[model samples]
Target: MAVGGGLSCIKYLMFAFNFLFWLAGTGVLAVALWLRFDKRTEGLFQASDAPSTFLTGVYILIVAGALMMVVGFLGCCGAIKESPCLLGLFFIFLLIIFAAEVAAGIWGLSNKDKIVQDVKQFYTQTYNNYLQTKQPALKETLRLIQFGLQCCGTTGTIFDGAADTCPKKEGLDAFITTSCPAAIDEMFDSKMHIIGGVGIGIGVIMIFGMIFSMMLCCAVKKGRNII
Candidate 1:
């Protein structure tokens, strides 16, 4: 089989893309596992009465990560072997993943306010519980939220009770800083554009994968050397 210059380049690109996809899958899986085992959050998972919002999201990510790995494997093998069957399968899985992503984006957009409110409520509850109990688990959890968000307590004012455990500040910022609730709002408001951009970028890459897979499949079917 004599593969042409153009097709050979595309084949290599396909392999590269699939390799990166595999790495991304690995990263997602690692993050999911971390969240599953992290001491501060693991306690929440152990309790039966614990809220399911964050739990559900972690499970979804684990499944998605695994699925991406499988799809990526198929794509890589198909490209390397020039197998029409494998490439077709890869295309099908990519299409399904793309559809799922689109559906998720739509759902997230439709329930933006609700999701933000729920998260804020969860933070508020955690903060209040910490103020009353002074438990280690709650303190660690509070620290995670504060440091991760770079925000103080729910009130955003220096007078907030949980401010002591929040992210450290210097001078004026030590007293005047954004609140956790405000940070959450920014996540759904101004910061949401960054998330949307990432989504679009991923979607574009997936489109390229699907396109290249089909193209390679056709090029191989026509007896063009792809290897």
Candidate 2:
């Protein structure tokens, strides 16, 4: 009965892995759609013509999809080898990651509101602080903001074409003289990297689980004289 139960458990885990594999596939598709449509029309999204929130939502989905894929692979091995020890370990690791992802998702959902408010506040503060006293500088700053916003919503080429917006007047020439590069680095420097790192670490754990389960299966089969 113990052997039969272990085998059943392994079968269920393999199915679970298959489900997660499909889930990750869908996530990648969603990201592709966002890159194609939403990214190029940030201003439209802000005006509610299109859903811009997907940009952030898709990022979360990508991370979750990766985690599911790793966990599913580990589960598959555990089921194939009929090793309760491996499946049990895989479940424990999955639970830890699942908890963390849920927490992060919750925080992200809440933070979306906070981010919009904060950006608005920053813009207001900058206008009040710099608009009057530095009228010449203020115009330059607005130009920088416009360029930055455009580049942020578009391609990296926006930064290269910045000289086209130049030919400044009086003190404004100093503004053109100053360089305001778009924050292209933010894409990779996101906090998502930490989650991805953890997922990779968990993948290593799955590798060990697969090896151990295979050896255990081999040993049991040999001792029982069973194929």
After superposition, the stretches of candidate 1 with alpha carbons farther than 4 Å from their true spots are 1-6, 23-51, 130-140, 158-164, 167-175, 187-191, 224-227
- Model 2 clashing residue pairs (backbone): none
lDDT of 2 by residue, 5-119 (tens): 4544535545555455445434444543453344322322243222335446555656655666666666666666566576567657666655665576567556655544443
lDDT of 1 by residue, 64-124 (tens): 7788888898889989988889989999999998898788778768877776777677778
Task: Looking at model 1, report the run of 10 residues with the lowest lDDT sum.
Answer: 40-49
Off by over 4 Å in 2: 1-18, 21-64, 118-227
Give the TM-scores of the predictions, in the order they appear.
Answer: 0.72, 0.40
Model 2 TM-score (2 dp): 0.40
* CA error at residue 222 for candidate 1, angstroms: 3.3
Q: Pick the candidate with the highest lDDT.
A: 1
